[model samples]
Each structure stands twice: as C-alpha cells, then as structure tokens.
Target: MDYKTYKTDDFLFDESFRQWTAGTSPEATAFWEQWLTQNPDRVHVVRQAQELVRALNDHYQDDATDARLTSELRRLVRNAAERREAEAADTPSIPLGQRISPWRWASVAAVIILLGFGLWRYGNVNRRVAAESYTHLTKTAQVSLQETVNTSDHVVNILLSDGSAVTLRPKSRLSYPAQFKATTRVVYLDGEAFFDVVKNPAKPFLIYANQTVTKVLGTTFLVRAFESEKNVIVTVRTGRVSVYTQQDFEKAQQSGLRRIQGVILTPNQQMIYNLGDHQLMKALVEKPAAIMPETVSREQVFEDAPVGKVFATIEQTYGVKLLYNDDDLSACLVNLTFTNESLLERLDVVCQTIGASYEVLDGQIVINSKGCK
Candidate 1:
C-alpha cells in the first residue's frame, strides 16, 4: 500500500497498518520503522491514525434484548401462518378426526414417568441457556490477564496485544492484558523496560510502577522502576510522555482528562520520581541524542552563518527550541562551519565564538551572555 500520502483515516482502515500498530507482525514493524525514518513528516499523522484504531477496538457487547425480540417475531409469524393453514383446510367447520383408543391410554401410562421428566428438563433448559450465556459475558467482562517474567540474561522482547513492544530487562516482570479494553491500555511494570508504543491517540498507553504512572499516546521511551531503587525514572526518546504520581489520579478525575496534570517530558528529557520526598525532578538525559538524526550523506554544513540562523537550523533538525537570555546574544552574529558535529558541539562552537554559554532548561537550549557588540 502507498501509505506515503495516506491521511489518518486511511491508515486506520488499512489492515496492514493495524497489524503494524498492533506490533503483532515483526515485518510490518520493520517496514513502518524504516518508512518513518525516511519520511519523518508523516510520523505525527501516523501516530494519530494509530490512536484511532486502539480507541475503536474495545471488547464488543451482545444485546440479549435484540436477540429475544427477533426470536419472538419469528414465532409470531409462524403461528399466523399455521392459523391460515388451518382455516384453509376446513374454512368454518373443522372435523374431529380421531378418538383416543385404549392403546393410546395405555401408551400414555407407559411414558408417564418419562413425560414428567421431560417437562422438568424443559423448564430448566432456558435457565441453563441463560447461565451459559451469562458465563460467556462474565468471561469477556473480566480482562484476560497475561504476565511476562524475564529470567534470561538478555532482555526479553515482549509484544503486547495492542502492538506496543516492550524490551524488558532481565529479572524484570510485566503484567498486562491479553486483549486491551477500548478506553485505555495499561500494563504494570517492575524493574526496567524500554517501550516502543504504537500510537493510539484515543486510547493512551500507561505504565504503572510503584507509585508513579507514565502515560503517552504513542512514543518510544524507557521506564526504570526497580524494586531495589528508591526512585522511578521515565525517559522520553522519540515523542512526548507524561509522568505523575498515582495519588494524583484524583486530580486528573477532578480536573477532567482534558489536560495532563503532570510533569510533561519531551524527547531526550527524563523525569525522576523520588519515592521518599514524593517529588518529581525533570532534567535532560545524561547523553541526549538528537530528535532527528543528521544523515551523514545529506549533512548540512554552514559557513559564517549568523547565530540566529544557526539556532533556527538546530531547532528545525532536532525540534529543540532555543531561548536567548538577552537580545544582545541573539543578535550577535558568529563565523563558523559545522558538519557532522553533535548538536551540543555545534552549540558549544556558536556560544564560544560569541563568548557566551548555553544550558538546557526544560528540554530547551537557553543562551546566557552579556551583550556582545
């Protein structure tokens, strides 16, 4: 399928997309990941379509009332037809055809016990049917739980029914559903895992660990909530993720689900939830990777580029915003050429050239310096 030009709805309707999003098909995931890397602009739209699919695939319900009504209608039609047939057979006067013989009376006596048992059996048949159907309904209502315990020395590749892939580190455990409900996809995490979640905007993906909960629509991220550690940490890789305490669920309910009432983390950002203090610390990752990689072949090189232009290019390539402490540093032009340097290296050159310094604040690069003429 030519998914390149497909909108959100188109992707939702495509079975291949479903399989891909569900993470059930490894081939589809590889194809999709490659396609996304090649066509970065489509990532946002694809994520939206993925969300729509999850939201719509809830466990279905069967309406017993409708079924009963259909059966009653059929019975009524059959009775009316039988009445017409009787009238056609005799019109005004139907003759009594036969008198009960002595043999028939004897036969009734012969089967009297059997007939009584049959009547009793018939009375209980409907109740049995109701009970069986109720059992099926109950089974559906109760979620099919599945658990993965990684005992291997290497990380375990666990594929969730909803298509999210979890790379569970050794000695970790994850509990999730065999089938997800329509509203939300939840999984319990203990220890460390990296999740490459398929996007389903309508149904958000949640990872609950100890007292912390990490939620996202669709993103690549990591969660570390080992029983040995006192803090639960969540780090974003590709998209946005939100982290909050379990106690704040009431806050979400009171405020409504319209807004995320938690600390939001963008790509290359991480949030650590301190179990003791009950506080969350948001900061940049130790080694922050670029949001978008610079293809070595199509690398961009600047020669004597203005500092503002340089900042804009960095923002475009990596999607990281840069804020100037003052207008003086913002206007100060720099002379430099950059090729294949890491984003930080490029930023360091730009800042050093203008005798300024930069720091990442809330996933943004903030330049700090006195005025440079």
Candidate 2:
C-alpha cells in the first residue's frame, strides 16, 4: 500500500500499522520503523495513529467495552459493504444505521474513548491526546476553518487573511479561518510554526497549540507543540507575547473578562508549558541574540567601567533583565571587550571578574555575591 497518501485515520485502520503499534508483529515493526526513517514527514501522522491504537488497546482491557466496540465495528463494516453493493446495483439504499459517524471507518473504540462523556469515564486516557489535533480543534472550534498541511520536506508559508504570515514546518499543519472574526484572529497549530503577526491592538492574535494559547498584538515568535513532544514552547524573536494555559483562555472567554492573564514574554525569551504537570516556565532562548546591538557603543570596549554600568549595557543590548544587589555589584569594576559574545558569555566574564556567580531565575539572570571589594 502507498502509505504516503494515508492520513491518521487511514493509518489507524491499517492492520500493519496497528500491529506495529501493538508490537505484536516483528515484521510490521521493522517495516514501519524503516518506513518512518525514510519518510520523516509522516512522523506526525504516524504518532497520532499510534496513540489512537494504544487508546483503543487500553479501552479493550475492559472486556465489556471491548465486546461492544467489536460488535459495533463488525456491524459498521457490514453496513459499509452492503451500502457499496447497493450503490453498484443502482438501487435506493436504506440508511446505513444512522449516517456513518465521522470516524466510524477508523475504530469504534476511538469514538468510545474520545467522546466527551467517554473521556470523563476513562480515568486519564485522554491525557495522551494532543491539544492541537486537527480533528479535535476543528470540531471544537465551532467556526469554519481551512486547514493547511505541510507534506513537503521544506517549510511552507501560509498567509492568513489578517495579514499575518505563518512558516509551517514539515509534517506540521495549521488550521485557520479564511477571514478572521472581527474581535480576534485565531489559528490552530499541531506541530512547529513561526508566526509573524501584524500589529492589531484592537483585535488580538491568538494561537491555540498543545495545552497553551499564545496571544500577541504584533510579534514574531516560534511555537513548537508537536504531538510527540511533552512540552509546548513559545520563543519570541521580536516584540512581546502573552502565553496562557488553554484552560485559562476558556475561562476568560466564558467570564467575559477583558484582562489577559499569563506569562508575558519579550524578545529573546521563551515560555515552556509542560503538558504532564501543566507548569508554565519562562526562560531565555538557547541563543540570546542582541536586540539593540546598533544602540551600543561602536568601540565595544569597557575599561574600568562599574559593574552596574556593564550590566546596564548588557541589559540594553539583550533586552533581558538582570537582578543583582545594586550596592554589592556597584563597587565592582570590569575591563572587558564585547565583540560578538552571547549574553551568557558576557555575564560569565563579569561574574568571574567580580568573584560572583550568576544563575538564571524566572528568565532573569541573578548575580550571587556577598559584596565586591
């Protein structure tokens, strides 16, 4: 079978894929792992299908639920074949026992486990489901949306109606409206994407990803919320953005609250939302780029400059706040040359010179020392 065109639903129904997910057939496992290695773009779809298979397997642990779903699946298959036969005969067919549910072809177990009430019944089975699943978000959105899937190896650019641009990475997908609502421009993302939002203070731009909602007026940021990953990361490149838990966003909407509550990230900062414990952590990006390099002195040399002055320059250049005892650090002096060194590297030199240590706390660098003579 040409698995390239197969979607999540198709993979969920494929016996070989199911076997590979269940680890029942060694041949299936070898084939799928090698296939995934060769076709890396399908990793997202394969992961989703694997999760569905595991969910069904978990549900089947309950014998009663298993029997019911098994019976339902057989019945649905029979009805589908009968309907096909009826169509071939050119006869008006009877209703196929209540129009085939949207996902009947995949697995009845999926419907049983993913339904609203079903989720409540299954202890924590729904935890495996990613918050950014295309079907999940689109169905719950209650608005018309157009979905763009990036199947190629290269990044795909999507221009939203709101003049925003999204750089969708390979194997990722974006669902957005042809035209945004008057109040807000909302988009749903399932994988990795970089968003360059246009400034519109009136209508905020919101991105719904795994367990997190990123709100921006106008900024450039990258969001990584892949299903296989445990954390949802929002890294800001320019401007500012507010990151909120998906639960908080819904609560604010229902309460008609106008205030935005969440972690506010500026340039060179990032927010990591852990899906397991639902913790939101703010930290600096791996490589901190100078935000205002042009404003710094052209000489790029500091001679006998007060430590506070050096820290001020560093803060101004990187746009990151540094915490230190003003009096303790003010007595220190530093002789340093700043060329293209990173923010942390500069901090290291300054800290070493003053016999102080620096640690990152809540996205801010804090200098630790008793007093610098």
Candidate 3:
C-alpha cells in the first residue's frame, strides 16, 4: 500500500482557520463565505483544524502531575554536556598528554563548552514546542471561550473559521470559542457590530447580544446594543437575520432561560426591541442611504420637514445625539437642502429656518423655538 505524505505547509490554510475559530478579525469572517464557495475542500480541512486546536487548548488547561517539567529541563542539560564531550573527542587538536599552555587548554575547553551550550539551548526550545503543542488537548463537552473588542475610530474586521467576516464598531466587544464544535458557531457580543456572515445552512451563526440573540445563515446586517440605549437595534443591509427576545428563548427551553419574541428581517428592514417591555417593532427602511454621503445632493432632502424629524434624521445619519429645549420648536417645520454643511452648521441652518435658537450642550445640540411657524 502506498500513502502520500503531506507537509506542514499543506496546512497553511489552518492559519486562517485558527483565526476564525479564535474569533479574531471581522474582515476574515466576511471572506469566509466566499472562500468556502471557491474552495469547498477547505470545509473539511477547517473543521479538522478547529478540532485539533480545541483539543490542544484542553490539554494545556489540565494541571501538571508533579516535577515532570523540572525533570525534563535537567535531562536536557545533561544531554548537552554529553554531546559537548563527544564533539571535543572527535575534533583533531593538541594531543591529550602534550604539554600545552594553561591558557590554550582553557580556551579550547571554553569553545567546546559554548558549542555544547548552544546545541542544548536549541534542543530545549524544540522540546518546549513539542510539549506546548499538545498541552491544551480537550475531550468532548468542554467549552472554549474567545473574545475580541474594538473601540477605535476605524472599523475592526474579523474572519471566522467558516470564512465569514464581521466588522465591529467602536466600543464593541465579541467572544467565541477558540474552535467551533459540531453543532453551531456561537458568539457573544456587546455594543455594536456589522456582520457579513458566510452561508452555512447546516451550521447557523448565532450572535448573543445582551438579552437578545440574533441567528443568521449567510447574511449582512448591523447590530447595536448600547448600555445607555433602551432598545437593541438590528438592521439588515443584505441577507436576513432572525431577532429574538430573551423570553422567547426561555419559553422554548424547558429548564434554562429562553429568548422570546423574534422576527426575521429582510434586506432594507430593521428590528428594534425595547428591553423593558420586551416589545419588538419591525420597520421598512427606504434602501438605507449611506450613513454619511459625500455628495449632499444625493442625501435625503426635506422640503418642509418638521424640525424634530429633521433633527432625528440628521442624528441617525451622522450618529449624533440632539436635544430640544422647547416642545413648540420641535413642531416647527424647516425647508433646507443640506449636503455639505458641518453638523453644527447644519443645525444652525435648521434652527434659523424654523425661527428657533440652538446651543451645543454636552456634545448635543439643544433647540429652543420662539414659536411654531
């Protein structure tokens, strides 16, 4: 029987696989689907790699029995000494009985000792690597935990083992196992993240956000759950996502807490759930306009939009918070085509058009209307 041998490089694919299993980059997660589509053979390879990593993690978690580590170190040192002795004997040098200067003999011994030490150190490093390779091995039923968070101005990308990608927003945190198991790809998230999930109908991607759980099989969407906000928002830019309440899952589960009240969101739709009431609302969003459009002419326009509505739109589009000092001012209408105004300038224009006054207060614009027009 003839068998083909595969080198370690044959497993280069495992690097990306490990990253996904480790739940690191959102960009990697986004590419997962396309990669899987292109390289179908990698599916099996990735699964095997995940299993191997999980096993290694488990093995390392176990406590060492005794002084085995110390004993190994000692053995390594002795091996080095013996190798040095052998090399000294094999080298052609001054005769053993020749009357040589003390310094020359010392120099010869010192050179041999240094060479021996180098070999021993090299061997020790290899031994450590070997020991660490299988240190984290685990059996079935053990759970692994992995987490990643990005709180920068720039978008943070992650690639999953299955070739999916996730883009996390500032102040966002996510956690998953170092390796995925047979059943599903589960992740826990807090704050906000945008997922471009890979399609894997067999193994669904589950995102646990606060009390809500979002499940998707190959989709693109945005999820926001802020500690200060009363609602968790799920916006599906492409594909679909099922948003469920914690109670719904509790009812479904016989013993543990289950999530309840879930709705599937199609492209250009958003689901907003109130944490206090556990109520879910689905709204049809006009094809989501870019958050910040470079050309103002292409952005949403208001002929005579209410001041409140206009402000809300600006807040939503620019991700800023606005405040109104007087109810009368909020009801005032404004007509404006604002495309290139800085956020503050935009607010000033709106206030002037509506016969209202505004001041920046605590990073928010507060509007005071003299009277509704």
Q: How would you encode candidate 3's per-residue C-alpha lDDT over 1-373 as one tens digit per residue?
A: 1101221212223445445655677766666656668767556545544554444333331232225323433454356557656876897796778745434443343344345434654575455433322122111225777667796888899887778788888887776677777778877677788888988899988876656778898888898976557888888876678888644553565566454457877655688888655577876453444344654446557887777778877766554456675466656767778766756677778877767777643324566667675
lDDT of 3: 0.62
Off by over 4 Å in 1: 1-142, 254-260, 295-299
Model 1, 1-373: lDDT tens digits are: 6777775545644667777877789988898899999999888778866764454332111112334433433454345446556755776554556544433433332234234334544565445334323233234435766778899899999999888899999988888888888999988787899999999999999887766778899999999987567888898888898888765753576778766557988877889888666688888787767766744225576665567787887776665668885467556776666667777887888888888898888667788888577
lDDT of each: 0.71, 0.80, 0.62
Q: How many steric clashes does model 3 contain?
A: 46
Highest lDDT scorer: 2
Candidate ordering by lDDT (highest first)? 2, 1, 3
* TM-score for all models, in order of appearance: 0.58, 0.63, 0.39
Best by TM-score: 2
Q: List the candidate 2 regions with Cα displacement exceeding 4 Å.
A: 1-132, 258-261, 293-299
Task: State, as a TM-score between 0 and 1, how close model 2 is to the true structure.
Answer: 0.63
Candidates sorted on TM-score, descending? 2, 1, 3
What does candidate 2's lDDT look like per residue over 1-373, in tens digits? Answer: 7999885556655778878998999999999999999999988768877886687666544323545554544554456556656755885555878655434443543344356224443544364353445568877786899999999999999999988899999999999999999999999888999999999999999998876889999989999998779999999988999999887777789999988578999889999999776778999888888877675435478899898899898888888888989987767778988777778888888888889998888888888987777
Please report how far candidate 3 places residue 81 from its true position, in Å.
89
